[model samples]
Target: MENLTFEQLPQAMRLLHEKLDRLEQRFEEQNTLQDAETIFNVTQAAAFLHLSVATLYVKTSRREVPFNKQGKRLYFYKAELDEWVRKGRKKTMSEIREEAGQHVLSTKRRT
Candidate 1:
């Protein structure tokens, strides 16, 4: 890197301070708004989950996915949907093998 002269150092520092202040303002603006819970209908929920509405309907009828029934209307909570996706997470093959190894070792110790 080329060395900055004494005169250039103050100007560089001042420019950095201005950029930092702008970034701080943007962050503050983003966080100042209150976040409210969002509800999604079947169409929206299916779109959010990247599935077809028919599939979502089937899943909901089968009680496979998290949902709320209000009269005949179906509702989904955004947070609940996120949790549902998280709960369906599958472990990798290596992870399953490692867990099996641990179980085998524990069982042998008890024998």
Candidate 2:
């Protein structure tokens, strides 16, 4: 780092403050975007989920996917869609084994 004279310190500090303010503003913008819930129509939802529109429609009709309906339109929240996908996740073999062990322990006689 270059040495700064007392006279240059204030100017350097001002520049540093401006850069910090910009960084903070960017961080806040990113947080605002994350805090906003994304709502997607059927087509957009289908694209997000990598499903064909017809297949998405079928799933919605079957009440298999999380969604909201307003009159003739369907709306899906991105967070809810993410959770719905997560709900279908298969347990790893170790997880299944742990669950089975717990079940066995719970059912065992106390004697």
Which candidate wins on TM-score?
A: 1
The residue pairs in collision within model 1 are none
What local lDDT score does residue 50 receive in model 2, on the 0 to 100 scale?
100
* Model 2 lDDT per residue over 18-81, tens place: 9999999999988767634889999999999999999999999999999999999999988799
The lowest-lDDT stretch of 10 consecutive residues in candidate 1 is 28-37
RMSD of candidates 1 onward, in order: 5.9, 5.7
For model 2 the local lDDT of residue 6 reads 96
TM-score of each: 0.67, 0.65
In the predicted model 2, the residue pairs found to clash are: none
Name the best candidate (by lDDT).
2
lDDT, model 2, position 108: 92
Clash totals in order: 0, 0
